[model samples]
Target: MTAQATTSEPAASEPARRKTAIPKNPGRRDLGLRATLLFPNREIVERYYVPVIYTACRTCYSEQDPDEIFRRALAGDFDSLKMQKLIGSVIESGHGSTIEHVVFTFAISGVSRTLSHQLVRHRAGVAFDQQSQRYVKFKGAATMLPHSIAEGDPDLRTRYEEQVDGALGLYGDMLQAGVPGEDARFIFPNATRTNLVMTANLRALIHMSGLRLCTMAQWEIRRLFQLIRHEIFSVSPFLGSFLAPKCVPLGYCDEFNNRDGHCPIRPHKDRVLEAWAEKAAAARAAGRELPVT
Candidate 1:
């Protein structure tokens, strides 16, 4: 029997072997370069957020109030470089709402359903639309073979294929057997991945990117964000530049697990606080005062 044919298993069965494979031509199977910016086109960006957000940062310091600032910014009364500098500083200071006014929509294609499931967990500041398993019968559905499976033991990898194929086989059988698609879908594994389209405002995109960009985020999701970041950079490098790991903005790592400081992204927030406290104590002992932000 064909290795593919022999490797099938029931939905409840575990893999016959423990090996996982990384695809030989990984790039061929890669969810390569997914996510296309669909709306709020470049014209909209040059006409709107670039100026609007710039105005938001400048208004506070300028003698002119926000209305006047916005008018002048849109009217090209100020240099983009000066405006960007102020926006950069204000954003760094945690003024997030000013950047929230602009949004980006991406046509995210070729991601696994697995990635999409974890992605939608983010409730605030984002939106999503996925390829519906119910609406789409998936006559020619595709599946992802994880890198682990690709690079595993041959025997173990064979077993893994069998399990995935068997699950897909049962799904097809159930569909042909008149079982409802929803119920038949119980056989689908987390690996039975799918695709989606997602959208977010600059605030949300940056926020989500921050969380998922962390080392703690799942690898697949991290890779996906890297692609998303690339897409943003293609259009407006200025806006795209904001998408980054959360620690980049925080100036230090805050994750509790980093107490040992292994992640190395930044000094732990606790450690920094403790150092500040120690300095304060020393100052008090010396009859001096610690300056506060």
Candidate 2:
């Protein structure tokens, strides 16, 4: 008889391995999520987006009128490099209004309602119009299957699919019985796919990206932002660079859940503060004072 191999679980006494933050790479698989830059293509962005922001920033400091500054920018009188440098500096300095002059519109589709619920929470400098379930009755509504459930035990995965299909079927039955679409939609699960059109200014995009790109964010939404970042990058790499995890610019992770320092992207804020305290203590021993910000 041929020898057989057997798998064994880890010893009970062994410590569980710490989960490290792995940055998500988009386009790995078709999760059905799609984010397309619906407005302001490359040419439009290259010609107007930068100039518009530059005009906003220049008007704040220059004695010239805003219209004149904008006209000169559009006419290519200003050096593109110089405009970008000033814009970069102003953005870094937190002059958010300067970058708010330009906006991007994206047609986001195939994302779950769960993701949309989290996405619509962002209000400032952003506008969203989502597909209304009440107005448009879905003939065959599709649902998102989470990776965990999809990859779990075969029996469980089948059960999850059945549960989702049953809900959708019941919804269809209610509609056939003359029930209102709005009332029938009550049977829809959070996993039901949704479509949205979002328009956000530069400042708001950066702010939203910072929060959503963090390792602590929900996986589905993080993936959506990844797609958003990719769409932005396709138009202007300079602007796309600003869409990053909050910790990348902050220099420390501030999420309360990161206290254990599991996410390796950056040291936890507590660790940073602890190091500062140590330095301060060492300076005190030397009879000197350290500046505290």
Candidate 3:
């Protein structure tokens, strides 16, 4: 009698709950990003971007001929930081051509198709050759599902699988219907990923890295830059050195979002200017000269 009463308590009052149809985390997922020098190699950079920037620097201070300056820079005589400071100012001042003479090529692979789509949108100063979807038939096409959907509330996870699976099925049907591979690929979602190799000069790489490495950049593409930075570091820490968050070399952050002066990679430009003004006022009060850069 006790067992029967205990089991009968309150079935009607218990809220109905949906059952989970799937489980999560069968295994680790890979970002699968990779980067390596695809062209110009180590020899080319050790010979070029350095000497190129060096010449750009020395041309300002030297009485010697520009060609003569290039010869010594290529041969190595002056400190790199002095050259870098001048180059930095030139870049900041929008004289970008001085850094354009050198280029870096990267083999970028296994990034999401979603990222590659946004990445190829860069209209100027970069080149890319992506793995073709048009010519390649899907013997077994692969796809990426984000961790959120991968390890998600069960009903949501089921919906995501159904969507991806349904997409693949439609793609196969389209091909079977004699649709062109390109047209059929319209059914392919961003989760259907790809690889590419890209080449860009130092100026462009710096420009792209600044925007892409920022916290504003989409996470997958940011991861790609992290790998790219690692690859460049492997080749030449000296030159690979320049490809970084713009804040790193600027000594002050310029990000609009950082206007509150958070991220301490550098003082925000606003804060820096405020500090300068305060210093100038203090100097005037003390009847002393304020040094200027």
Overlapping backbone residue pairs in candidate 2 total 0
Candidate 3, which segments miss by more than 4 Å at Cα?
A: 1-29, 60-63, 77-94, 250-293
Estimate the TM-score for candidate 3: 0.74
Q: Candidate 1 — which residues are off by over 4 angstroms?
A: 1-33, 56-71, 277-290
lDDT of each: 0.75, 0.88, 0.73
Q: Which model scores highest in TM-score?
A: 2
lDDT of 2 by residue, 1-293 (tens): 10111224458998975544564432245677789999989999999999899988998899999999989999999999999999999998889999888899999998889999999999999999999999999988978887667656989878878888899999999999999999999999999998999999989999999999998888789989999999999999999999999999889999998798877899999999999999999999999999867
State in Å the error of residue 179, model 2. Answer: 1.2
Return whichever of 1 and 3 wins on TM-score: 1
lDDT of 3 at 138: 78
Compose the digit string of candidate 1's lDDT tens values, residues 1-293: 11111122335665555433211222223443267788777777877778889877766677888888788889998888888888887778888888887788888765666888889998877888887777667554556666666666888888977887888888889999998887888887676557777878888899999988777676677777877887788777888888988988888888776677767667788889999999999999999999888
TM-score of each: 0.80, 0.90, 0.74
For residues 143-183, write the lDDT of model 3, one tens digit per residue. 75666665569798777778877888888999999999989
**Regions of candidate 2 where Cα sits further than 4 Å from its true position:** 1-20, 23-27
| Ranking according to lDDT, highest score first | 2, 1, 3
